[model samples]
Each structure stands twice: as structure tokens, then as C-alpha cells.
Target: MMVAASEILKPTGQKPAALTIDGLSLEFPTYAGAIKALDDVTIEIGASEIVGLVGESGCGKSVTTMAATRLLPEGRYRVTAGSIRLFGRDPFAMDETELQDVRGKLVSTIFQEPMSALNPTIRIGRQLVGVIQRHEAVSEAEAERTARGILKDMLIAEPERIMRAYPFELSGGMRQRVLIAMAFSCNPGLIIADEPTTALDVTVQAVILRLILDRAKRTGTSVVFISHNIAVVSQLCDRLYVMYAGRIVESGPTRAVLEAPQHPYTQALLRCLPERVEPKAELEAIPGTVPNLLDPPPGCFYRPRCPEANDQCFAKPPSMAPAPDHIVACWRRETIQPSIKASEATQ
Candidate 1:
């Protein structure tokens, strides 16, 4: 039987959070204007816990992952507020050398496009060896041996052949496996997977998801999974954070939030899922586009599209409310339950 993320055992006397982003706000400067990409985003991932960041496209899910990994470009993007800590170390404050040390060894990322992340010119084995060698004071031969071992552990058939092959020679699923192998090469404490299964087919996606969950469980590694697919998040994550227009709209234990979503945006997203529709029934879509971050409207970022929006929603932004283990930033959460009930009844 596979262990759930919450079932993983933690080391004694360790801090509760392996990763924490407190009041994080980021902006990008373009000729158009400065676009606020993240606003007061606060989230935490405990040791061995899998936390999901879910939103529609352009909702800052990728930005949050980049910020946590310290991979955001320096001049193009700026952090106007908030702090991010990984394993109690401040990645933003670290010098280049120090940051380099922390990146692959302490933290690793599995990007959506494996072709872009992997070097096409280099042999897969050589790249994996380089990663291991960079983080450890080991001989080239030793690094190669370790690389092969990691690939084998990922359940790749003919691990030696895979190491010798270039990334272009591998299938999409195979290439993704290599990326997962590299991310786990150094036994990183925190792994950021930014839609790692997006390009895969359904069957392959299931395999990749299982590989990730299994590895994290075996190693007790914390994961920050970013996805636009709520189904994927619901399957893998212990907790969920819903983002819209750079702001977190709702967050709580995944089951709690999914079963009884408190914010209008979150509730609408769940209702839009394919499973919620009867056969031959038309799909539901959340009306309106995401707000323009450069010139976002006053008050709630989601107000313009919210079904339950009122005068108070246009007058001021809603603060997070104390709702047991859940947090919601909506003025009409109290009335949302009835709306959900009515929507369900219609279906």
C-alpha cells in the first residue's frame, strides 16, 4: 500500500514548516506597467506534506513556484513585499554561491516542459552526473554511478541506455522521468513541481503522478505542486490554496475546501469540473477573464466576476476569515453555502 503525504513520519525536533511564504507580493515591470503578479500570498508546507497551488492560467501559480525556488529573473520581476523561507533559510537573502548551494541540494524544481529544462545537446547521464557532482564533492565516476542508481530507482527500463541517450531521443514520458530523477538526485528537502504532468497523456500522467507521490513518501520530501487541474490537485495534495489575480482566495485542507468551498471563485471552479456535469450536458465556465494586474480594480480582485459580489465587495478588499482550518477572503462567505446548495440541486 502507498503512504499518503500526511502519513509520512517527520524527524524529531524539526520545524513544522519546510517551506513558508509570508505576505509575499511580487510585480513585473513592462512597458505597459508594473503588473502585480502575487499579492500577500501566504502559504506553508510542513515537512513531508504535499501542498497544492491551484488556479486558472495566469493566476500566478507559476510565479509562486518561481519565487519559492528563487528562480524569478532579477531585473524583470521584483518582490515588493513578503518573505520566503525554505527549511528556515532565507533564499532571497543568500549570496549567489550560497543560493547555488541551496538550489539543487536543498530545493529542486520539476518544470512543466522537460525539453526546455533538459539540455538537448548533452547526454541524459552526463547532465544528471553534473548535477550530482555540482552538489557533492565526488569524482566524475562516482557521480555517474549515483546518477544511474537514481534513474533505476525511478523505474526506468534500461537505466544505462537512458543515461547514454540524449533527451531528444527519449519519448515525452521518458524525458519527464529523467527530470524527476534529476530532481531527486540530491535528496532535496523541498521539491517544486510546476504542472509537471501537463504535457503528458492521461495514462502517462497517472504513472508520473504515482512516481512523484511514491518518491516523496519514501524520502519524506515536501512538495509544492502547482496546477490548473483541480482533479490533479485533489488527488495528490493534503492541502489546497486557491489563487486568483495574484491573491489567495481560499485555503484549507484539500478535502474540506473541495467538499465545501467557501469562496465564490473556488466554488465556481469545482462546479466547472467535468465530473460535475451529466453526460451530454453543456460544460460550465466561470464568466469573465482574470483581472488586469497592472491596473487591477479597487477592492476585491475577483469582485467583477463573482456571482455573489455586492457593494461591499467593490468598496474594499475582504480579509481572510477564521473558518476552522480554512481561510477565505470573501465578503459573502456566509451566503456562499446556499449558492453551492442551489447549484448542486440544479445539477
Candidate 2:
């Protein structure tokens, strides 16, 4: 369907596109010129699927989210071209009233820091009750009760007491639990969890992850879990999409991608996982830093750091053609030596 289309600075629609992004592009105008935050990006999340958005910092991950949600400040960034559709309808073209109806009720976000996401001065119960009533039409007392119930599911020892306390009174993990509670309260079609566990201890991180995965399963909620950690994604996501310099370099089923990485960037990511590999073992890092978004490499963004880069790699953007179910944007997919053969070749 040709959904409503909005102007560069406008926002549009409510229903989720099953959610598809077609030829998406976003840029920021600076004194120098335009910094390309996203370039010809395309992705789709099926209903109830947990798809991951994986990348190192500055790969345009967060920028992609901000643009998708129309959360960007006016005039600060620009959507030069493309569509952000939910349910095949244009979110950009939706009017302000429609946008408000869609954003939190149909789509919600869990930020990297809970403290930043929550109001420090307000009590947790008030915040939770307000969100529930805003979208759900529940009475304040009923919403407050629902909030306590969700907090209990997070395994909080005293959900009632915790709800009454301010965000500052709660621990970091406690605050995160409350965030998850709020997100679930709406039962949104899609939930964007951006680095959701970055602020807590390792033990608490595991607990929060389990709670997220468990609750998501029961709700059958489609999620876009953004993270720099591969191990965490492996545990939660059904599929993985790896980004590099504002484009997706690799995407596939989680287990297959983890076991047999086809792109050099994907390989480097797995090789750098400290938890899965030995502590004393030498880690593999892509040699160069990510290229400047303002003037990204002419061809492949990862060409400078790819060990197997060839003359052809510098001449054109690699195609993300299908290789089984996985789509890879590397010229060396066929050339990647099998792990077993590589070991023998080394010997």
C-alpha cells in the first residue's frame, strides 16, 4: 500500500508494517556538509520475531532508532529519502495526534540508562500508573495495581513498596525492572530495547535479560534489541543483523551466523567476544576505526579493516545477495576458508 508520505521535517501512521523499512536514509547537516547516518537501509521485522540490531558504537544504530520513531529534534537531522513503514503505512505522514497514538501505545522503547528514561523526582508508581492509564484507559488504582503485578514478575521483593519509592530510592537494577514493567504494560506490537542492560552489574544484567526474554515470549512481542554484545544477542534474538558504517554488512539466523560467519566484520565481532573466548588469548580487532559518516569510504565501509580485501572491494559496494538464508555484503564470502581447513592450512 502507498501510505501517507510526510515532508522532511514532518512525522506520519500508527499500525505496525509487519515493520518494514524500505530504502531508508537519514542525514545530519553540519557546517562541513551532511553526515550520512543511514544510507539505503532496509529491514523488516515479522510479527513476534526478536531481531537484533548489532554493531559497534557510531555505526548509526541509535540514529536509525531515533529516525524510525520520529524522536529526532526538528531541523537537527534530515531524512533525505525513503520510508519508515509500520503495517505498510507511512509513519512519517501521520499527523501529530496520530503519531502520539502510535508511538508509545503501538511502539515503546527501553533506553540504555533507566535513570535517564525515568523521572528521578517522581515515584515509580506514579510514572507507571500514568503510562498505563494514558494508553489503556484503566483507572489510576487499577493501573497502579497492574504496575505492581508487573514488578512482581520482575522478581522484585516488594513490588508495592518499590512502586511507592522514587526512582532515586531504587537501585539501578530496580529502575530497569520498572522500565521493563512500563514497556510491557502497553503490550506494544514492537519494543526497541536499546542497550537495556548497560547500567547494571553483571549479575543484575543476567536477571534483567532473563526477565525480558521470558516476558517477551509470553507476549509474543516483536523486538529490536540493540547491543554491542554478541553473546547477549545470541541468547535473546532469533535473527541477527550486523551493521557497519551505517549499512547492514551481515544478517542471518543467530545460530548459523554465530557458527559460520561469512563477512570479515562478522568474524572479527565473534573473535572479539571475551566471554566465549579465553581471557589470555589474543583478541582480533578490526584494524582501523569506523570511517567518518560525513565522508564514508567510496565503496565498502569495512574495506580498510578486512584482511581479505581485494581490488574489487574498493571499487563497489558489495551486494547483500542471498547465501542460503544469510545475506552478506562482502566480496570474500566464497573465499572465507572453513575453520577446519584454516587450522590445517596454518599447520
Candidate 3:
């Protein structure tokens, strides 16, 4: 039986975040100069919440996840500021051996491309068994049996046959299922799914999303679900963080942000969704391109494209303004809400 996402809840009061990223700033050097990939980005995922990180390409969504996993390349990527804690422990401070133990065992990741993530040379069964044995003190036979059982749970038919087949032999959907099985096999406390369904068909995409949500709920695992599709994020996540130009422009409970977005960038994002358009009307697209990280705008990065931008936006960067459960980084957040409300009312 599949567990409902709503049923997965953290107990109230002082519970540490499963994953906490505080004032994280990362930069990469190039001939042009240093490019800030992330800038003072802060986010938190509770022990059992499925939080969605939504943004367009090059908004630093994937980079944030890589940083959380301690997978950022040395020398190429530098952490300029801030900290990342996984279940109360700083992953950055851990030694190589400790970091390895934290990965796969404490936190697992489902990459965007299953083909790239899985080894074509190794048989599927051996890969799954290897992950299980590495994290658990199980015999080879026991590990193989556990792998088969996990495949069965993922609704794969003939789990034994799949184990023997190489990654090249399976369909795209099957390969993704294998990766999901490997991720959940260790019962990791946190799972970072970085666009796990981007390559699959609509039907298969729905199935994969359900599997991830159900498995997370059943195991009480916190999930950071990253995606470019706002619709998909709205459907699956309890909370949402809207990223733009390497900064989180807005964030709040999924329903609140989706229903009445305050930031102009987030409002434009919603306007671009297909469902928001009338049958004959043209699809909306946000104007202007993502800012060049090598030389981003000094104040508000989205000021060039924001309809509500003004002199204040150009003079000083906007900080996160609290609004009930929502947090928006826009100087005009108060003034923008009424206009958005009127526009929504007209629609």
C-alpha cells in the first residue's frame, strides 16, 4: 500500500532539520573572472517533508544539491561562505572516510539521468547488491535477496531476470527504477532527487513521482525534490523554494506560494505555466535571460525583468520579508500583493 504524503509529518518543537543550508555561497573561477553559482542561499528540509526546489536552468538548483551531498569538485568549485548540516552534522567538516559513510548510507541521491548514474558494464543485480552490502552488514545471498525484494516493491516484473541484465538492456523507465531501488535500499534519512523524471514519458513520470513519494512516506525520509516544472513541484511538495539567478527569490508553503505569488519573478513563472493560459491565447514567457553569474546585477538580480522594479531595487538588494507563512525577497512585496490579487480576481 502506498502511503499518503500528508501522513508523513515531523513532530513539533525543536526537531533539527534533516538538511539545513545556511548562507551558502559557492563560486567557480573562469578566465572571465569568478562566477557566483550560489549566493547566500538558505533552505531547510524537515525529517519527513518533501520540499521542492523549483527554478529555470542555471538558477543553481542542481549546484545546491551537489553542495549538500559534498559532491562538488575540488579546486573547480569553492565554498566562499556558509554551512551545510545534514541531520545536525556538518558534512563539510567530515573526513573522507566519514563523508563516504554519510553518503549512500545516511543520504542518497537520484540523479537526472539514470543511464549516466548506473554502470553499463556491471549487471543490475550486482550493482544493487553492492550498494546494500556496502551500507549493511548482510551476506551476499541476503543482499541479493533484498535487492530482488526492493525491485518487486517498485512494481518491476521478474525482478530476478532484471538483476542479471546489464543497464543497456533495460528501458529508460526500468533504469530509473533501478536507481530508485538502490537509493532506498539503505533506508537513508534524506534523499535528494535531482530532476529524476525529466527524461521519462508523462505516464512513466507520474509513476516515478508516486514511487518516490510513497517510499519516502513509508520510510520517514526527508526528500529535496528539484525540478524545473512548477506544476510537478506543486503536486508533490509540501513546501516550495523559488530560485532565480543563484538566489532564492521566494519561498513558503506550496499552496500559498502557488495560489498568490508575491515576487514578480515567481508571478511571471506562474504566468508561464500552461494551465494558466486560455485555450486560444499564446503561452506566456518571462522576458529577458538569466543574469550572467560572472557579472550579475549588484542589487536585485531580477530587477531587469521585474515589472515592479524601481530605484530602491537598483540601489540596494532586497532581503527576505516575512508575510505570515511566506517569505519573499522583494521591496515591493506589500504593494505587489494587491495588484496580484486584483489580477487574479479578474482572471
Candidate 4:
């Protein structure tokens, strides 16, 4: 295996940060020209921080993760430009074998679907053992022991028996736990969890999310948790990046972004939450749908949907700047205050 020797999850915590993505823009060449899936996307994850990439469906959040890991599928997608550096190594330039080592050993991932991720034909133990043995120079017996230990740590009961069973034999929650075990088995520096709880129930989701958080917190494993649920992001992320279309419209400390969103899109997203936001009141909703990415507008992609959008929004693009750690890309954010303020006045 060709695992990079410099991953950040070292026991001493002395390694450099896990990743740094700069002005990353990934485009897909369709028959209808380039679809700008990611427009100047930039974010970072420290060695031990859990950052949330929050956005609506098809906002390029998952695409960003897939591109960063060099896992983009055949012909359907192409990265026109951008840089994704993992442990200071460029993922885009790495060879296939090199990428494989980085994927399972240094940086692991958990997809939205657990059943598909876990092999149906193989026993759970065999799958786990394969993952470990793929990276480590260990005998089958040793690999099996390590795999069993990892599963047990994930709170999987009867690890020995569960390992011997197939993926179909386990419940959904159990299957998710097994996937989590696999991701963390290599002691990866970064875990890209792409909506890890989507297939799980509410209570099960909570348990799984908590497990992920507790594991990362204990292991000092940095995570890039991508989800469309703002409420969930509020609970788990130390920092939040709000994506609209293909760009980051707002970003800041989770509390700041959640409590006092600055951008029109951000405010709209908060308003769109279901009823009972406060102690005993119905929640407001954000009006309008997301912009089309295949043929994005001339200026701001959100102009059509932004309540505060004006001539300037259609004139030229707005740049990110001094909005505390918080940032808003709306042309009228300077004059746009969250409706939460106006709602209080009426009350």
C-alpha cells in the first residue's frame, strides 16, 4: 500500500492540519457546456475540528467531497480547476494506487447509504479485515482481531458473531455502525461523513451522530460532515459553511450563523424551517427554489430567489469579506437584516 506517511491523526497531535482547499471550483462537462457545480469553493478543517457543509439538495456539497477524495465517477464529471490538498499532498495529481492508499488508510469516508457501502456478498468480518489488510502488513489472524476490536468500539454488540454475519443480517443501525467501524479502523486523520444518518430513523440518527461525534472527539479525528439539515449542523459543527447554488453564501461560528444569519439566502433558509421554532409559535418558511447550476445567471446565482436582490445583484458578483468570522455574499446584505428582527417588532 502507498499510504502517505504524514496523516494528521498522530497520537502526539503534532501533525499539520488534515486538509486545505483553495478556491476549489469543479465543473462537469455536459453536452450543454460546463455545469459549474462548485464555484470558487474554499474551506478548511483543522486536525481535530468537525466542520459542517450545510446546503440544500444538489448544492455541490457532496460533489466537493467526491472531488477532494479523487473519487469522481467516469466521464459524467470533470474538474476544470481547483486544488484539494490532503496532509499537504495534492489529491488531484495522485496516481490511482496512491489515491487508494489515501482513501482507506489516511482518509476514510461514510456515504449516505450504508447498505451499498458494505459488501452484501461478503461477511462483515471479512470486509473489515480486507480494509485493514489493504493498508497494514499484517497476517489474516491479526487483521481479524483488529477488525473485531474496531467493531466492538463502535458499540456493536456481539462483535464476534456480527463479524461472521453478512450485511443483510444486521439491522440498518447495526450496518451503519459497521460502516463507521470501517471508516475509523485505519485511524484516519479525516473522516468525510456525507450525511451518515440519512437512511437512519430520527432516534437512530441521533445515536449515530452522537457516536460519530464522540468517536471523533475521543480520537481527535477531524470530520467534514455534509448535510442539508441546518438543525443537525447547529448541534454538531463548531463552524458552518452555507452553500447556495455552487458557492458559499455564509460562514461563521455555528451559533453566529444559526442565531443571526446575515445573508438573504441564509435568513430564508432559517425561515423555511417547520413550525414551532420558538417556545410556542409556528415557524416561518423561506420562499422560492434554488437556482439552476447548468446555466447559472450572469451575476449572483441567488438573485432570482433573494428577497433583497436588486440591480447590483444582477450587475456584478459580491466578494467575501469582513463580516466577523461570519460572511455573507449577498449584494444587499449590508442593508438586509434577518426577519427575526422584524418579527419581534410585530410581536
lDDT of each: 0.86, 0.79, 0.87, 0.81
> For candidate 4, what's the RMSD?
5.7
- Across 1-347, the per-residue lDDT of candidate 2 in tens digits comes to 11111211011233243577767889899999899989877777777778888998988778787777788887898888878877566878987888888877888889989998998888888998888888888888888888888889989989889988998898898889989989888888888899999778899999999998888889877788999988789889988889988888877787767677788888877666555455587766668788988888878889988888898889988867655446777777788842322232123
Q: How much lDDT does candidate 3 score?
A: 0.87
The clash count of every prediction, one per candidate, is: 0, 11, 0, 2
| lDDT digits (tens) for residues 1-347 of candidate 3 | 22211223232325567888888999999889999999988888887889999999999999998998889886798899988889889988898899888899989999989999999999999999999998899999999999999999899999999999999999999999999999999999999999999999999999999999999999889899999998799889999899998998888888777778888998887777666557778977888888899999878999998888889999987877765457788888778862343246236
Off by over 4 Å in 3: 1-14, 338-347
Write candidate 4's Cα lDDT for 261-297 as tens digits.
7887777776766532565576565666776678888
lDDT of 1 at 172: 94
Q: Pick the candidate with the highest TM-score.
A: 3
Q: How many backbone clashes does candidate 4 have?
A: 2
Query: Ten residues in a row with the worst lDDT in model 2?
Result: 2-11
- Residue pairs clashing, model 4: 272-286, 275-283
Model 1 residue pairs with clashes = none
Please give the TM-score that candidate 2 achieves against the real structure: 0.90
Instruction: Give the lowest summed-lDDT range of ten residues in model 4.
Output: 1-10
The superposed Cα distance between candidate 2 and the true structure at residue 192, in angstroms, equals 0.4
Model 4 lDDT at residue 272: 62
